[model samples]
Structures are given as C-alpha cells and as structure tokens.
Target chain A: MKVTIDDVVLPGDFCEDIIKAGEKSRVILGPGLRKELEKIFITKAGVLRKRAPNTYWVDSYQKRYVPARGENVIGVVIQKAGDSFRVDVGGSCSATLSYLSFEGATKKNRPEVQVGDVIYAKMLVASKDMEPELVCVDSNGKKGRLGVLNDGFVFKCSINLVRKILNPSCPLLNSLKNEWPFELAAGMNGRIWIKANSMRETIAVGNAILGCEYLTSEEIKSMCTNIASILAGHVS
Target chain B: MTTKRPQLPKSVLEMKFMRKTRERIEKELENTQGHDSLYSNIITNEMRHATGNFISESSFIFCEDLLEGRLSYKGMNPEIERLMEQDIKTSDPDGEMQKDVSDEILYKKMEALNKKRKSNDTPNKNPVLKKKKKF
Candidate 1:
C-alpha cells in the first residue's frame, strides 16, 4: 500500500512519496523506514512523520530500547566487568561501558562507579551482531551531563513520550519549570529520572509527565496548572 | 600478446637518482600492467558507475537534533543548570554576539581601524628614523 506523510503505516507498506522525493534529491530514511533496492518499506507500525527538507521517520510507541549510536540513554549498571561495566538499557543485550570512557579516568585512577547505579551515557557503538558500547564522557573529555545519576526516582514510559516531552516545542517543560523546582533526566531508552525537594513534589512531577502522554498541548497546559495548584495545598 | 610498458619521465629518472629507485619505478610499471590483465575479467562496468551517496545509517535517533536530557528547573540542581547554560552558550555564539551589526558596519569598522593603524605607524616610523639618524 502507498503511504504518505503522517499516515498510520504498517510493516511492508511502501512509501511512494519518499521514492518520488529521492529521485529529485537525497532523502533520509530515519528509524523505521528502510530502502531496499529501489523501494522504501516501513519496518515498524507507527505514524510516518516527515521533517522539512527530506527526513522521514516512524513515530512508534515502543518500550524496548534497541540501542542506537549517539543516543543518550539511562541504564542501570548491572555488573562490574574487568575493564568495562555492563549496563542494562532495556535492550536485548546489555551494553558495555569502558572504565576509561569516563571523564579523567586513568589506568591508575578508576571512576567510582558501582553496580545498581543509574547512569546517563551516550551509546558509542550499537550493532546487532555485537554488544552495544557506552561512554560517560564526550569527545571533549567532559562528562557534561552524561555520568552517574545520583538520588533520583527512575520510572519507565514509552519511548514516544520521552521524545514528545523533550521536543523544543513541547510546553510541558516550559510551564512546569516555573511551577516547581525539580531536576529531570529523560533518557531516550524509555526511562526517566526525576529529583525534587520532597516526595510529594517528585511524585507530582512524575504524574504530570506521565499524564501528558495522551493529552493535547492545550490540555497539558491546563493539567499542569491543576497539578501546580494541588501541590500548592489548594483543592480548587 | 605482450604489451609495451609505459615510460617514466626522462627528466626525473635522469636527475641524481639511485639505481634502486629507477628499478623500483620500472618494476611498479610492470606490476601495474600485469595486474590489469589478471583482474580485468572480474572488474565490471557497473562497479565504475557506483556512487558513494548511498549511506546506510543504523541509528534511529538523530544525535545532532536532540538536546541534552539532564536539565534542572529553577535552580533545583545548580550543577546541571550550569552545564545546560554552558551548552547553550557554546552551541549559539551568534545569538550571544552583537546581532545588529551588518556586513557594511563591520567593513566600515575594519576600514576605520586600518586608517588609525596607518596613522600610528607613520608617527612611530618617524621617531624610529630620527633615532636611527642620531645613531
């Protein structure tokens, strides 16, 4: 079946629009779209989305994390291996994080990372045939936001929700930022870690985020206001 | 049938060269001609027309398009907030820079600077010459 942009696409659905655009210029098949020979086929069941210029992707609601290179994911350190630590990022296989990948980590001086510690790191190498590799530091040798996350509540949500809330146009963060003081780390691997002053505040932040999954922009704004008022000790 | 070997530049081979280098160049020409016929049967015309534009990208997420996930609200975590601010600062230097300055204004400023520099140079040279003459 021929599918266009924003259409609910199933696996094996061919996108003629992308093929037509590719003839004129280069077209980027992002995520669930695959190009075999001359035809573009959908690999995942989701809404086919297109960005300006020539970028097409499928926005699917997925809970399992298929490791991808350069994506920042939150993972729990499962075991401390010889030179690397194994981390479970909700993927089929556990990712390996090298000890030297951490910022300022040397052969003599190892980074103090233990098992069960939640870490936010970028996937350095992710492939189907091999185990995924993760790094705590970027190319600049700066940990910069990727490192061991301490004292935060971690919860699971659909990967789509993570992208939705983190979008620049999303008003969820913009409105909630002023409402309360909280720290948030939304991993691309369907995991969110939030920290606030009190338990009530933390739960409220989590609820607000999870609640915005199905709500529209205007509805999310109103929902945020309601949550803020309830947290402020007001019934109405 | 034997093919004639291509000759090297006579000028280069003639100039102060070692016997080893001259032998190497002749050997390289012979090797090239030998390999061409050896693999000519396998090399197809389609291989020559194949382009490098077909890129196989494995990752779903566009790393460049995403923002840093760790963020703080209203100074909840000062460390994370500071890092976020530094990220914004480094990513967009133009936004922090003087946005109103046009190309004409920049050119005019450079021209005025050059004029002032020339005026300063002339005065400094006169003093240096006066000192040199005294010496």
Candidate 2:
C-alpha cells in the first residue's frame, strides 16, 4: 500500500499507514483484505506523479513564527518582576525586557515597564538547549516602542493566526486598514495581544487571525465571529 | 583529521534544543524516503492482526525494526464516537445499541482517565512562586 501526499488521507495518517503497510509486506506480499487496505491507500502512481523534488515535509501543523535569532518581533508584557518584565512572544517561553535595556535609563533602580505593555523587541539569541533572549535596545542603544499597552483587547490566538495578522497582504488588515488604527504585538511564544479602541476594531482584528493550517480571510473572519459570539454568550 | 565537537556555552542551550528536535524529525523523514513499499506494509499487517481493527487516520505510525505494539489510539477517536452516537440516536431512538461499557478493566481505565481530567482541571494552589529568570 503506497501512500502519497494527495492520498485523501491526512499527512500524519498517510505517514502512519505507509509505515504499517510497509512493515507487514516485508516478508510476504499476498492477498490479505484488499478493501480494508484500499480504504487507507490512494495509489502509488498518484504519489509518484505528485512528488516534487523541492517539496518540504512538515508536521501536520504549519510553521508560523517561533522566535529565531536576529528576528525582530512584537511581544506583550505578561508579568513584571524587579528590573525585568516577562513578554509572551508566540512560543512556549516568554521574552524578557529589562529596565536597563530600555532607551534611556539614568539609574539602575528606575521603573521602566509594568505588565500588559505591548512592546517591540529584538531576539538576540535562539537556541535549543537554552531559552530565547530578547533585548529592546537597538544598534544605536535607543529604546523604541516600550511601554504599557493601552486601549486594546488581549486576544489569545494560535501562533499561525498571529502570522496571518502580521502578514502584509492579509485581507483583514486591508479591509480595516484605516478603520482601526491600533498597535499589534504578536508574541513568538504563542500569544497575541491586540490593543484597539472599540470592541468593533478588536473584533475586526480578531476575525483576521487564522491558524489550523491554510484558511482564507473570509473563513477566518467567520470563525472569529462565531468564537466571539460563543465567548460573549458564556460571559453574558 | 578528527574534528572535536565544539563545546557550546550554557547560556545558548535553547538554541541547541530546537536544532536537535528539528534534526531528529528531518532525519526520520529522510530515512523513510528510501525504504521499499514492503517495509511499511509489514508493520501495518502485524498491528492490525494484534488489534483486530484498522488504524485510524490520526494514529502515529512509525516502524523501528520491532513490529511490537507500543501505543495505540483506541479510545482517542472522539470524532468517530460522536458520529456513532448520532447514528445510534437516529436509527434507534430507544437507544438499544448505546449500552455503556461495563467491562471491569475498561471501567477502571475510564475511572482513571476521569480522575486525571479532574485533577488537571483544578488550578495549582500556589500560582505565584518566583523562580530564577532564565534567558
């Protein structure tokens, strides 16, 4: 039973099916139950036809942005302690924004940022064995876009949705381009907090968010509305 | 010339972890590319023989020499269960085929799962314990 990418089966399912089929057929390849096996199999020829050399295989979930070194990102301040604030990017770990890393700090004992601030930060290092390190300071040592997030709603969305919102050509951004003027901080550690004026704007931005692998803006907006209604229903 | 493995600094461990997982998955994919069709079929047949059922589309299928059963998605098919429930309700409004599983072994498993779910639903008592900040 040869499986291909186009085999109607989900990629994860196909991978597993092929592995099972291969293992069983190793010693003896005779008639077992054709219909049972055929249910999972598409065709070996179909797979061969569709196979492309440049094709890259990934997990069932598409990759959005997981913090990588030298990549510039926007994050939200989730927790504050002493001289540093924990910023949730869009991955598993939160980025740290130190008071000393801010633009102009005359004293080491100065208050800089508190929780719930959506700020722009830069990734200094991204590694597997250690946590990702981020700094707000630029090449010129100037602090930019570091402050408390005011007048906005925090949206807990999939990391891919954050990518869709940040995507330049996302229809949600285009449709509400001038309608809603607000700052968006998409965390690399898997959280996005949007600060907007009205509930309408927040909802509009939320509608544009998409994840769960490959969806158009219209589909995402409908999902957002449905989800928002459910949440609203629960609260009310 | 034998090349020595460079010792990475302790501060950059996270970078190394991502690289390792990425490499492992990629290597698996690469190794699978060259194997013959018979390899996957053999593994599939043995599992089906043992389970007496076909594997679901969501099952994680991997073969590493041993054809022995390690894990399964037996009770994880929620979507199929929902469909089955709806079918039962439609065909037999009296719910004849909707008998609950009363097998002692299965009952114990379900009870354990319920306990685990209940425990997870409860939030940690001490939510605000401070730890050293890892960069």
Best-matching candidate per TM-score: 1
Candidate 1 pairs with clashing backbones: none
What tier of docking accuracy does candidate 1 attain? acceptable
Error of 1 at A23 (Å): 2.8
Q: Residues A152-216, candidate 1, lDDT per residue (tens digit)? A: 89999998899888887778998999988999999999999999988999999999999999999
Q: Write down the C-alpha DockQ for each prediction.
A: 0.33, 0.01
Each candidate: fraction of true contacts kept? 0.54, 0.00
Candidate 1, residue A171: CA error in Å? Answer: 0.9
Best by lDDT: 1
CA deviation > 4 Å runs, candidate 2: A1-66, A71-83, A88-94, A108-111, A116-118, A144-148, A208-214, A217-236, B1-135
- Candidate 2 residue lDDT tens string, A1-236: 33444443332233344335444543111111122343433211212112122111222222344556655566777887666677777656876767677666646556556676666677777665666777876777864433344455565555445444555455554444344354455554345556455566556555555342366767655555555465446543
- Number of the top candidate by DockQ? 1
